[model samples]
Target chain A: MQMDERKRKILRAIVQDYIATAEPVGSRTIARKFDLGVSPATIRNEMADLEELGFIEQPYTSAGRIPSDAGYRYFVDCLMGAQTLSDEDKEIIERESTKKICEIQEVVSQTSRLLSELTSLTSLVLGPQKGKSAFGKMHFLPYQPGQVIMVIVKENGVVENHIVDVGDNLTAEDLQKVADVFNQKMKGYSLSQVKRSMLHEIYSELSRQRHLIDNALEMLDAILDGSEEDEPIYLGGTLNMLNQPEFRDLDKVKSLFKVFEENEPLKKLLLPRQEGLNVTIGGENTLKEFRDCSVISATYKVNGKTIGAVGVLGPTRMDYGKVIAIVDFMTKSLTEVLARGKPRGYK
Target chain B: MQMDERKRKILRAIVQDYIATAEPVGSRTIARKFDLGVSPATIRNEMADLEELGFIEQPYTSAGRIPSDAGYRYFVDCLMGAQTLSDEDKEIIERESTKKICEIQEVVSQTSRLLSELTSLTSLVLGPQKGKSAFGKMHFLPYQPGQVIMVIVKENGVVENHIVDVGDNLTAEDLQKVADVFNQKMKGYSLSQVKRSMLHEIYSELSRQRHLIDNALEMLDAILDGSEEDEPIYLGGTLNMLNQPEFRDLDKVKSLFKVFEENEPLKKLLLPRQEGLNVTIGGENTLKEFRDCSVISATYKVNGKTIGAVGVLGPTRMDYGKVIAIVDFMTKSLTEVLARGKPRGYK
Candidate 1:
C-alpha cells in the first residue's frame, strides 16, 4: 500500500488509461502516451513491482496489465484527481432544482431523475423521513356515505389524503363541525406531543358528544397509521443498466434486476446513517446479489437534520472518487434547493 | 437446424445441464446423468456431431462441451419444457396485485417487482398512456393569487395534479363555479374531443366571466399540451442488472447503468403499439445497448383499448417460455383488477 512518487504515477496512469479504453495497459503504451520520460524497460520493472504489491494485474501474457480492485481503491483514496462539475452540469442542476418545490415527494422524485440524468448512474432518493418531521396541519373532510377523507399537510407542504371507513353515515354539517374541532385541537402539535394524558383529558371533555368524538379519534388513528404511505422511496434511470457490459451475463443481470425489484433489501441499504457518506464495496455488502457491486450513498439533511439518503449504484470498479464527489455534490445541491422556498412564480 | 430425435435429446441435455451448472457438459456426464443407455463412446460420437452442427463447443480439448448461443436458442424455442410457478408465487402475485390495484402507480410498481422476483429478471412497466384515456373529471382549485391546482381524474381513477400559473386572480367561489362548469361540459370527453370551435363557442358564452373562462381555457391547454410533469414513464427493478456476470467488467457496467439512467431511449423502446404482447429478442432491438438483451412486453388495456405496456428484461439467454407466460398472465391479471371497481375485502 505504501508507494513512492514513481509508483504512484505508474498506478495512476494505469487506472486512468484502463478506465478510458477498458483495455489492459502495457508498459509501452503508458510510456508512449504519458511521456513519463522513462524507458519501457524501467516502466515494466516498476509495473512488475506494482503487480507484486497487488495494485495491478496482468490479465494475460501479452495483453499487458489493468488496475486491480486494490489499485482502484488506492487511486480513489489518494491518487485520483478531484472532478469538478462543468458549468453546464451546475447550470443543469440549478435549473432543474430551481423549479417549484410543491411537496417533498416532488422534490425527491425530481431530484432522483435529475441526478440520474446528470451522473448517468442509477440513482435512488429515499423519501423524507416522516419520523423526523413534526406534524403540521390535519384536516378531515366527508366524502360519500361512511367515507371520511383525512388530509395531513406537513410543514414542507406535503399534503397526503387517506380515506377512512367510519361505517356510519353522518350529516355533512356534523362532519364539518368535527373537522373544525379536530383542526383546532391538533394544529401545530406533533403526534408525539399529543401524549396519552392529553388524549385522556380531550376524551373526557368530548365524552358528552361521544359519537362525533369517536369518529374523529378513529380518523386520527387512520391518518397516523397511514403515515407509511407518505414516505415513498424514489428510484430513477434503471434502463441505464442495459448499456453496461458488466450486466451482460444473464444470471448476474437477472439477480440485480430482482434485487432492485425487491426493494426491501435496498431500503435497508439506504437507511439513514448518523454521519459521513457510507460506501459499501463488493464483498462488504450483505446482499449476495449486490456483492459484485458498490453503492455510494449519503444522507441529505433538511435544516441540519438528516432526513433522507441519496445513493448511486454501479460496478465495484465504479469511479469511486468521482461518484463519491457527485453524490456529495448532489446531496448538497438538494439540501440548498429544499431550504429555499418554492419559486415566486409557482403556486 | 434440422435434427433427429437422438440429436435433439443430446442438445437439450447439454443446454439444461449448462443452465443449471454453468459448466461445460462432458459426454460421459451427460450419458450417465441422462441414462441415455448409450456408452460414453457412443455419446461422444453424438457430441462430436452436435459440435459440428454448431449446437455446442469445447472450451478446451480435455474439457466438456458447452451449449452455443444457437443451441440455447433452440432449447428455448423447441426443447425447454414448461416451468410452473410455485403455489407461493401464485399466492404472492394474487395478494400483491389485489392490494396494489387501489392505486395506478402501485399496480405498475408492484407488477414490476412481482415479475422480477418471480423470474429473477429486470422488469420495466411503462406508465399508462394518458393521451389514450378519455377524461373522467377535471377539477380546478385556486391556490394563490395567480395559480390554480388542476387535478385531472382519468377513467381508471388515476389522479394527476398540475399547478398552472394564470395571469389573473379569481375568488374561491369563482374557481369552484369554473370547476363545476368545466366538469359539466368536458366529462366523458377526451382531450382531443375539445376542438378550437368548441372552445370559441364556450368563450363567447362566458364572455362576461372573463377570468373564469380564461383560466378554464388555460387549464385545458395545459392538459392538452401534455406538460412533462403530467406523464412520466415508470421504470422499476433495474438494480437487478447489477447481479449479472456480464456486467462484471467495470466499463461495461458503467455504460449499461448509463443507458438505464437515460430513459429517453427506453421510452422510445416502449413505443406505442397495437394490442397484444410484443417480444423483441436480441439483435431485434434497435438500440445498440440492448443487442444482447431480450424484452418481453405487453400492452395493458382499459375499456378494450391499449393504454400502456408492461415488460421484463433479461439476457438473450432468458427462459423465453416462462417469461412469455408470466407476462401474459400478469397483463390479464392487471386488466381484471383494474376492471373491478374496488378490491374485495379479504376474509
Candidate 2:
C-alpha cells in the first residue's frame, strides 16, 4: 500500500500508455517511449512490485501489464498533471453554450452534446431540479368546450401544462379570473411550499366565495401534489461507446446501454452528492454495470444553489485528466448560463 | 421474369430462409427445411435462374446465394403473406399505449421505444407537426424586471416558450391586455394562416396605439417565421443495431450512427409522401447511408389531418410482414390518442 516514488512513476507510465494506445504497457515500450533514466530491467522490476501491490495486472500470460482500478485512482489523485484544454475545445464550449438557446431544457441538452463531442464519451445531463424553483405565475386557457389547459411557469423558467376538465360553463374570462387569484396568492412560493401550506388557505377562501371554482382549485393541488415527473435526463453520444476498445465486446455495450435506457440506475449514478467535481473510477461505482467504466461529474448551481449535474461516462481507460478538465469547465459554463434570466438573445 | 410459378416458390423459400437465418441459403438446407417436393439439384437450377434474373447473389465464390434487394422487394410485393400479431405482442402494444402519459411527446417517445423493443431494431418517431395546428392561446408572464416569458400553446397540445425583453415600463396587466387582443384574433387559425394573412391586420392595429407591444409581436413573428425546428425526431434502440451480424463491423456501425446523429438526412428519409403504410427496402432508399437498411414508416393523424410519422429501421434482412403489421397498429393507436386531446388520465 505504500506507493514509493519509483512505483508511482511506473504506475503513471502504465496508465498513460494504456489510455493512449489501449494496449498493455511493457517495460521495453516504457523505456523507449518515456525518458525515465532507469533501465528496462529496473522498470520491469518496479512493474512487478506494483503488480504485487495490486496496482496493475497482466491481462494475458505473455502480455504486458495494464493498470487496475486502484492504479487509475492513484494517478488521478496524486500523479496526474494539471489539465490544460486545447484552444479548440475551449472555443467549442464557448460557441455552444452562448448559442441562442431559450429554454432550460435546450441549455441542458446542448451542454450534454458539447460534453460528448469534446470528450468522445457518453454524456448525461440532469436538467435543473424543479423542487427549489419558486412559482412565477399561472394561466388557464379554455382549450375545448369542456377542457381548460393550465400552464404553470417556475421562477427558473421551467414550464408545464396540465389539462383539466372544467366543463362547458367556464368561459375564457371566468378562467382568467380564477387564474389571477391563484397567481396573486402563490407568486413567489416554491412548489413544495404551495403544495403544503398555501393549498389549505387558498382552497378555503375560494370554496367560501365561489363553490363552483373549487374544482379548478382542487385540480391545481392535484397537479403539484406529486413530485415533478417531467424532469428529463438528457443522454448523448451512446454510439461513442462502440468506438472504445474496452467495449469492443458486445455484451459490455449492451449492459451499459441498458442502464441508460432504464434511467433509474443511471439517475442514481449521476445524483450529485456534494459541491464540486467528483470522479468515480472503475470498481468505485456501486453499480456493477459501471464497474468497468469511469464517471466524471460536477453539479451546476443557480443563485449559488446546486440545482443539477452534468457528467461523462467512458471506459475506465479514459483520459482522466482531459475529461475531468472538460467536465469541470462545462459545469461552470452551465451554471453561468442558467443564472442569467434569459438563456440567450440578450446581445 | 414472367410465367414462373415454380420459380416463385423457390425464390420465396430462399428469402424466407435467409431472413430467418442471416446466413446465405444453400439448396441442401432449403430442401431439408422446407417441404419443397423438388430435389436439391432441381432447387439449385432454379436458384441459378433466379440469380440470373437479378433476384439473389452469392456473397463469396464458395458461399450459397442470398436474397438481393430486388429479391426482398419481390417477396414483399408478391410472396409475403398477411401478418398476424401474436397474443404476447398484441398485449404489449395494448399495455404500453394505454399507460398514463400526459404529453404528445411522451406518447411518441413511448411508441418509439415499443417499436424497437418489439422488433429488436432502431425506431424513429417524428412528433406532431406544428404547421397544420391552430393557435390555441398565448400568455405573457413577467420573468424579471425587464423580461417576460411568452408561453404559446397550439390546438394539438404542443407548448413553446420564448423569453422577450419588453422593458420595465410595462406591467403584467399591460402585457395581458396585448395577449388577450392577439389571442382573440389568432384563435382557431392555423399557424400558416396567422403568419400569412393575419400578421398585417394585427401588427398594424397594435402599432397604431401602443408601439411598445410591437416588440412582442415581432418576437412572435420571428418565432413562427421559420418552419418548426423543434418537431423532434425521437430515436430509440440504436444499440439494437449492434446485435445484427451485418453491423458487427465497427465501421458500418459508426456510419449508421452518424446518420442517426445528424438530423436532416434522417428527416428526409422519414417524411411521409403518401397515406397508409410505406416500406422502403435496401437500394430503394435514396440515401447511400441507408442502402443496407430497410425502413417501414406510417403517418399518424389528428382529427383527420396528417401530422406526423413513426417508423422502424433495421438491416436488409428485417422481418417485413411482422414489422409492417406492428407499425400499422401503432399508427392507429397514436392517431386515436392524439384525436382524444388528452394524452392520458381519461381512464
Candidate 3:
C-alpha cells in the first residue's frame, strides 16, 4: 500500500516489459532492460516487496513476474498521464472525423471502425439516440380511398410514417388545411414542445371540429406524439480478442462475447460524468466477466452537451498511454463533427 | 465428378466425423463410430484411395483423415439432405423471428444475432436496400424561417428527410398545397411509377410555373430524384471465430476478418439465381482469403421479389447439413417478417 520511489520504478518496469512481450518479467530481465542502475538482487528484493504488496505476481510457468489487476490499477490511476499522440495519429483522427459521411449512423459506424483499426482493440460507441429531436415537418398523404399516411421528420434527420384511416369524403385539399394548422403551431419547436402545445390546444379543437378533417388532425397528433428510437450502437474489431494471449482459451472468448450479446445492461457501465476521461482497470468494471479486461471511456458531446460515449475494451496489458490519447483525441473530434450535425452535401 | 456409393458413403462419414470432432478421422475411429460393414484395414485402404482422389486429407499432426474442400462439396452436392432441427431449435428460431422489434434495422440485426448464436458461427445479412419499397407518403415541414424539410416514407418503413431552402414569403398553406398534389398523384405507386409520371408531367409544369413557388417544386423534384443507398450489411458472432478449433491460429483469424472488411467485393460471391440456397466451399469463393472457409447463403425476398441475401461463414469443416437447414428456414422466416414490414404498436 505504501510505495516508495524505488518500488514505483521497479513496478513500472515489470508492467512495461510484460506488456511488450506477453511473458512474465523476471528480475534479471527488468534490471537488464531498464537503466535503473541497480543490480538484479536489489531489483529482485523490490519485486518481492511489490509482489507481497499485491502490485505484481509470479506466474507458475516462469520465475518472472506479471502485473496483477491491482498493479494495472495503480499504473493507470497513479502513473498514467495525458498521452501525447504522434502527429500522424493526430492527422488520422482529424481526417477520419472530418471525412464525408452519408448518414449519422454511418458516422458512428465509421468512427467505431477507425477506433478499432487505430488501436487493434475492440471499440464501442453508444448514443445520439434520436429520441429528443427538433420537430421538422409533418404531412398527411392519401393512401387508399379511406387510408392516409402521416409522415413526420425530426430535425436530426430521423423520419417516421404511420398509416391512419381517414374518411373517403375528406379531400386532399381538406387534409392540407389541417396540415397548415400543425405547421403554423410547430415551426421552430422540438417534438417535446409540439407535444406540450398539442396537449394544450389540439384536443378541444379536434373535439369541436370532428367533421372538418379532424380525423387527419388526430392522426397528425399521434405522429407528433413520439420521437424516434435509440440510435444504433456500433462495435468494431470484436475478433481482435483472439489476437491476445489472454484470450487463447475458448471459454474466455465465449464469456467476453456473452457480454457483447447483452449490450443493454452494458450501457450502465457508462457513467454521466461531465468532463475528463475515465479508466476502469481489470476487476474495477461493473460486470464480473470483464475482470480480466480494461476499459478507457469518455463521454462525447455535441454542441458542448455530452450526448454519448466512446470506449475501448482490451486486455489489462493494453497500451494504456497510447490508447487513451487516441480515444481522447477522437472524443473531441467526434464532438466537433456531431455538433456540426450534417455536412453540406450529405444526403 | 462421378462417385460410386461406397466412395460417397466414405466421404460423408469423414465430413460428419470431422465436423463433429474437428479432428482427423482415423479408419479405426470411423469403424468404431459408424457401422460401415467394413474392417479397419478395409476402411484404411478406402481412406488412402479417398485421400489420393483429394476427398480427404491427412494433417501433419495425425494419421486420421479429414475432409477436404472437395469432400465437403461432394457431401453437400450428393449425400446431404435438409437436417431436421430439433424442437427446441425450431422454437428458438420461431421465437426470435417473431419477437417484437422497433426498427427494420433491428430486424436485420436481431436476425444476424440469432443466426450466429444458434450456429455458433459468424452470420451476415446483406440488404433490403429500400430502393424497391412501395411508396408510402411525402411531407414537407418548415425548419428555420427560410428552410423546409422534405420527408419521404416507404412502405417497407424506411424514412428519409432532406432539407432545402424555402422562400421567406412562402406560407405553410402553399407547402400544404404542394403536398396535396403529391398525395393526389403519387398514391398507391412505387418510386418507379412516380418517376414515370413525373417525367411525363412535372417537367412541363415546373418550366411553365417557375415563379409560382419553384423552389419548393425544385426541392420535391430533388427529393424524388434519388433512391436509397445500400442498406447496411449486418454481421454478428465474429468472436465465435475464435471458438473454432480450426481458427486457433491468429493469422487465420486476421485473414478471415480481412474478408469481413472487404464486404463490397464479397457481394460478387452471391449468385444471380432467384430461388433456393447456395453453398460455396473453400476455394469456391471469389476472394482468396476465404479459400479455407465456406459460405452457405440463401436469397430472401420481400413480397416475392428476391432483394437480398443472408449467409453464414465458417471453416470448411463446418456442419453443412445443419447450417444449410438453418439458413433455409431463416430465409423463409425473414421473408415473412419483411413482408409484414411493421407490426402493430411499433414506432
Residue-level lDDT of model 2, residues B148-170, one tens digit each, is 77777766566666667776677
Q: Candidate 2 regions off by >4 Å?
A: A95-101, A134-136, A142-144, A155-157, A171-177, A180-230, A341-347, B1-3, B91-102, B134-138, B141-144, B153-159, B171-177, B180-215, B222-230, B340-347
List the DockQ of the predictions in order. 0.16, 0.43, 0.34
lDDT of 1 by residue, B102-218 (tens): 446666777777888777877877766555445656656444568756666555344545555655645666666656666776777665678787667666655656765665555
Which pairs in model 2 have colliding backbones?
A: none
TM-score (chain B only), all candidates: 0.78, 0.88, 0.82
Best by lDDT: 2
Clashes of 1: 34
Model 3 docking tier (incorrect/acceptable/medium/high): acceptable
lDDT of 2 at B91: 88
Reference-based TM-score, model 1: 0.65
lDDT, residue B251, model 1: 60
True lDDT of residue A193, candidate 1: 66
Residues A1-347, model 2: lDDT tens digits: 57788788788889999999999999999999988899999999888889888889999886999999988988999999897778889888988777765666678778888899899999989876665556667877555677766777656565666667675666677677677777898887755575645676666655543543565555545445344655568998888988998887767777777788776777777885667898888888899989989889999887777778899999999999999999988988887777664454111
**lDDT (Cα, tens digit) per residue for candidate 3, span B113-192:** 88898888888877666545554566676556767666666455445566666667767777776666666666656645
* Share of reference contacts found in each model: 0.20, 0.45, 0.45
**All candidates' TM-scores?**
0.65, 0.88, 0.77
Tell me the tens digit of each residue's lDDT in model 1 across A1-347: 56899999999999888766767899999999997899999999899999999888887887789877677778877897776776787777778877866456678888888877876777888866664344455545544467655555544444445455555755666555655555666666555567787677666655544665665555555444445444556777776665565666756665676677556777866763446577776666788887767778888766787767899877665667667877887888877876685421111
